[model samples]
Target: MTFSIVARSGQALGIAVASKFLAVGAVVPAAEAGAGAVATQAAANLRYLPQGLALLRTGVPPADVVAGLVAADRERAHRQVGIVGPEGPGATYTGEECLDWAGGRAGDGYAIQGNILTGPEVVEAMESAWLSSPQEELDRRLLAVLAAGDAAGGDRRGRQSAALYVVSPGAGYGGGSDVACDLRVDDHPDPVGELRRLRDVHELLFGTPDPGTLLDLSGELKEEVQSLVAERGYASLDMWVGVENLENRLVSGKIDPVVLARLRDAAPDGK
Candidate 1:
């Protein structure tokens, strides 16, 4: 019982999923920045993750990857999958044996699918949100679609877990890897809501602030920023930013006004 979206835009690729099963993220989602993404569920064949990604890496079209994967599986009739890459096209498959409300839709850069869902509206809502979301980041777009699907009557069986997985070359913490984002709500009454909350926090900690939108750190604001940093046992603002993994949000040596405000509000002693 799961719903998911696999998408590619520019150089980013990712997957967002929700389900009545536990840790659906671990079981259904897989992606590689600059290559492609895949979501395998409803009698998932775990092999599709690596194999699909491998196929994408080899420049195979997403539709071909889906065909190859389903062809290689003996139980393909029960499996559901979605795939998208940076080029060619996207594809989705819902086996004939999938539950009653099973189906999927493919678009310019995305594939939306589900099984044991409330109805076709679930995937439709997801597609609408993915297309209309104003966010430029693939992760945010994915989350928005998941939220939309949840609102549209997600898994008919009920929700237990949700996840957002993304990949981008050199986008991980400290530019050490490609795992741009990987957030999961293993078990929660409102996993989609929890996942949204985590996505916001992830952005605050890892998203790079726009230079045009950055607030200048100077005068009284600068002193306040320094005071907050020192209170946290950091010797300098840069140290605090680094320690908090705010490199992306605090690109310039100068502090971002939003960051300064958050630090002040988060001060343990309310300094």
Candidate 2:
């Protein structure tokens, strides 16, 4: 019915999940910055999300959290879960009653699990992608793994929805929240691909530019930037930066080379 990966990358924690069920994101994934991530599905015990994060915040190891949750549940045999914390490796569990082809794999900083998947290859491909994908952002890595699983014959029942949820301190809009990335394909025939498309849009709209990569906006370059912004219907260069949420990297009224490049890409005549 589903395939998922929960992982910890640097200061971020995230979960990526795909399912044959609609709105799987609303029920299967949860994470807290600097704490951990969890995916509870296959007769998911929603309590595992909050309780598991609470235990993780209190310094409980991921394995201990999984054990405690299963111990307390009378219907444990019907549940499947994956957990990864800010420190140490990850943990996962697939109950006996889950549909055929159900299983899981866990490794340093990540866990991959599935029920009603084609076979172990689904999780295996996810693990390979998570360990090998070159995406620096945790959410992108998670999405890569989800895409890998889908390519490896993901949910035996086919796709309906997919989601990516990631958190890091001060990573959200305006740097005021921990939700670095949260996107969902509530229903789609190619939900993982839809998720990838949305992730790209999210990056363009919300991603912060690297200070090391910024190109100075001055003299003729500044004039070019102003022209570009105005051509895009902005009243001023500053207005363009504000609308694109690039203020964090475009302060001092200087434009980022990436921003200039994006503006050029959006040129009405494709010049």
Candidate 3:
């Protein structure tokens, strides 16, 4: 019913999943910054998500954790799972009684699994995309992996939902939480494309500013920006940024060009 990839990149743990089922995000993906990621589908034992991370937190290897989980379940023969822990190696498990075309692959930093898929090519495409993807942020990379599978004819039942979840130390808004990027398309004719659009907007609003693009607000440029800010009804430039939730685009008295353009676009008149 679902296809998923659980992977580790640098210090990030992430999962990208899509299914014929609805709201897959609410149930399929889970990860902790320094612990691990888990995807439980096909007769999914929801407890495996939390329990898997707990085991990884305690230094249990992914293979051993999967072994323990399956061994303890009466429905072991029908479950499908993937795990990537803080330690030794990643692992994937497809139960003996899972639906046709069910299987998995695990090695190095990723585990890919799918059940009731159009064909084995779905998993193959995901694995290839993950292995060959550019050195970009984990969020983007995982989405590429998901899209690859989706293009390969994803779940034979059809697409309805998709999600991408990633976690890393101090990666959330204002460095407040471990959750990095969490986007979902609960039900859509093109869930993967919708997921990609949400990610693009997320990057615009919350992505880290590029250090090389930071510009000092000074002299004539500063005065012009001040005028734009005042034109928008804010007493100061910083106030304008605060009012519009653009604080993440401002840093140490400097601004990214994209943020400046955004302000210019919103001022009372053209720049």
Candidate 4:
């Protein structure tokens, strides 16, 4: 009923999951820095999240955490869990008697897990998606992998909800919302599609803006900046022109070729 990707970023960890079950996001996903990520599914016991995080807090490795959980849980054989730590420690567990189509993958900085799923192909596809993709922002890369799982016959029960969470480096709890992105699809006919829309919105606001700087300019430079801004796609060069730090550049009347290249990249395709 759940498929998730738990991953470690530069200094943070993230978890993203989707399932036909309600609140699946809450139960199947957990993450913590200095520790690792955990996904407990298939007759999941929610306590595993806190316990796993606590173990991680004590500097327990991912493999050890999985071992500890199995030893403690009376029903460990019936449970399915996957873990990946900051140091790249990884492990996967599947009870022999799990409801079929249950398994997982553990890698350098990520774990892909699912159970009572469509089939083993679901886990295979998820892992493939995760491994084949190039490194990128955890949010984008993780979601891309999840979407690929859906394309590969995700949950047999179908989709209902999903969410994504990532902590920022040096951010305290409730620290000015260091959560780079937090989104949930509580209910949707197309949760993944809605997730993509929301992620796109997130990128527009938080992703890098096109290269932009201001300078006092001569006739031609001023005209060029104005034209770029008026073209309906480029950022207004005037926005930075008067700034004290950038004043020198503006006064130069000619943009540096390197700077112009950056701006062009940002506004490529006139976007």
Model 4 lDDT-worst window of ten:
242-251
Report the poorest 10 consecutive residues by lDDT, candidate 2.
246-255
Best-to-worst lDDT order: 3, 2, 1, 4
TM-score of each: 0.93, 0.92, 0.94, 0.74
- Comparison by lDDT, 1 against 3, better one: 3
All predictions: root-mean-square deviation over Cα?
A: 2.0, 2.3, 2.1, 6.6
Local accuracy of candidate 1 as per-residue lDDT tens digits, 14-73? 999999999999999999888899999999999999999999999999999999999989
Q: Candidate 2 at 2: error in angstroms?
A: 0.6
Residues 1-271 of candidate 2 have per-residue lDDT tens digits of: 9999999988999999999999999999999998899999999999999999999999899999999999999999999999999999899999999997999999889989999999999999999998896557788788889989999999998889999999999989888999999898999999999999999888876776777777777889888877877778877777776766656556565556667877778754323
TM-score-wise, the better of 1 and 3 is 3
In terms of lDDT, model 2 sits at 0.89
CA error at residue 151 for candidate 1, angstroms: 0.9
lDDT top scorer: 3
- Cα misplacement distance, residue 242 of candidate 3 (Å): 2.1
Model 1 TM: 0.93
Q: Tens digit of lDDT per residue, candidate 3, span 86-162? A: 65568999999999789988888789999999999999999999989759778999999999999999999999999
